[model samples]
Target: MAAKSSQTMTIPTDAELVQAQADLWRHSLSYLTPMALSCAIQLGIPTAIHRFGGAASLPDLVTTLSLPPSKAPFLSRLLRLLSTTGVLASNEAGIYSLVPLSYLLVDGVRIDGDASQTALVLAVTSWHYMEAAMGLADWFKKDIAQPVPSPFEEVHGAALFEESMAVLDPECDKLFNEALAAHDHMGIGTVLRECHALFSGLQSLTDCCGGDGTTARSIVKAYPHIKCNVLDLPKVVDKNPSDGLVNYVTGDMFHSIPPAQAVMLKLVLHFWSDEDCINILAQCKKAIPCREAGGKVIIIDIVVDSSSGQMFETQLLMDVAMMVYTRGRQRDENEWSSIFAKAGFSDYKIVKKLGARGVIEVYP
Candidate 1:
């Protein structure tokens, strides 16, 4: 059963409506799935299972993860949810196997011959490590879904980009970058695998609001013929080496974007309000040529309802995450179309749907 059954089973049978509502209250209060997965990853459950000869039973899983007898059943419940959520899977024989998503976190999972442990990077999804403020009031009550400024900004008056540059904690910065890189590993890698056709015929592309150029590097690697530039604030470029496959340009997307055949904005617009998005899109408009000249904005981000096949529930949870983290919110097709119209775009097409994000081609 989809974990989403937890989200949609609002009304219950005729006899137990009161009991059902009481049960719903408790189930709705549980937000520990991601946290538990993080704990399992941090404790190296997959690694332990692998070393223990793969596909272990519940007791074996408990032993591998080092749980007490009292907590064994709790661990089993955790595993059950993790399995349902696509992180792990269970068998008829009662053994568990890491799914593709979890195996991707196995230490030394490689790409392009580079082997690095997924240790620190897995923190990206750790609810404790990546906490957003309380958006519950607005989220449960209001229809608007825009995220606030990132949690760091909510507390420290600075965004992650700014903090990465100004903060003196090099170790924290490195770990943070690793987390971003891991996310890029999934996000960038997913798009390249499922939607490479969108990059065809593009000779030049710039990643607006690109931090550290991980996505740009992925794009350039997939389409080596195309020249890619990552445009961000001056501080991010000052700290990062420009020697990668992607050229690094120091600039703000709202002020101006370097000229390119196309502008790629991934996980950016949701950071701003409608007015802010308009400013950024206007700058993107000034950067690219006409659609006939291959001028377009290639956006890889969640378009809320674009692909509701089985991910609608995950998408809704992600929408709440945005509420905690930024003033940005994921938009449905209508919301996107409205933004495109306001930005003076002629037409747009939602391309391939992959995982949580959908590839969108916006014409200038």
Candidate 2:
């Protein structure tokens, strides 16, 4: 029998121990960053600074926001944190200013008049999401055979998309749609610029699970010759009136999709499990023609790559967010390829990598 070797454990030096403590503390309190940002948004701090010609002193903000004088010190602390986190900029004079990050949070200032991330921030930092994130520890303690699939379901008693938010909370429903539209607007520019060739010769296209026809409208505007359709559930389609540009079809992608020369699934598959993704892609396959006929499914989603530095970290963060919110996860190249192959796709091509997400062309 081989003798087991005993490994000696070296105690961390004082400096190393102190550094480790700081790192641990940073990770432990990292949730405060988003919480502070959310609080700032709720208080209209970004807009207030924008109103002050892009700069506002502490007194200027308090006066403009009509905040009580007693809370000025507390507000100052919040601003300090926000400035430290790069959400806003602060000068030595203690005047707060909008940085590029905070500029997007200001109302009515859209990137190319398309969308602002204000809605996305609001939706993500809402109570329900925060509660689910808080419940993650307890969720992990559950047995493998437990009925609950996610922290969100554990808290809310149902999957997020199992029923329309319109039925559950009308305000949240509106905010959620706006959030998706905002996100799609931010990414659509990259897709159109980088993957223009994918849509050039297509006669018709379908945007599966498209929310509010945001991406569809952008596509139609870019390629006017191609007819565009937005496929979604009735709950989502009914609220969005036709603008005479893109046709909105009430349908489910898992069951069937309207036939098109090409199809696009923008940020949709990440919300489903692999089996569900395969089912959805198979339906997409049935909707489009063979690959030789210029038929393909364009997917704009996060393709996790560990070597991509900050982008990889963002992907991992979103992966955990998915774990808390749904049964889905962000996939790497191999995982994505496996799903595509299982869905009967013969081949696929990654057209471009747009920051944390990628534009993929999956062939039938």
lDDT of 1 by residue, 1-364 (tens): 4588768677667779888788888687555666666677787887777676667888887776777878888778878888887778898787888777677656666664333336444544543335434534434554533543455344444454446424634555566567655554455766777776788789999999788777788788789999998898887788787665988999878788999999999878775777888888889999999988999998878888735866887688667656554566777889888998899999999998777778899998
lDDT of 2 at 45: 95
Off by over 4 Å in 1: 1-14, 58-81, 84-86, 111-160, 164-177, 306-309
Q: What would the TM-scores of all predictions be?
A: 0.79, 0.91
* lDDT (10s digit) by residue, model 2, range 170-216: 77767876887777678686678877798999999999988888778
User: Which pairs clash (backbone N, Cα, C closer than 3 Å) in model 2?
Assistant: none
Name the best candidate (by lDDT). 2
Q: Report the number of the highest-TM-score candidate.
A: 2
Model 2 worst lDDT window (10 residues) = 1-10
On the 0 to 100 scale, the lDDT of residue 57 in model 1 is: 87
Q: Model 1: which ten-residue window has the lowest total lDDT?
A: 112-121
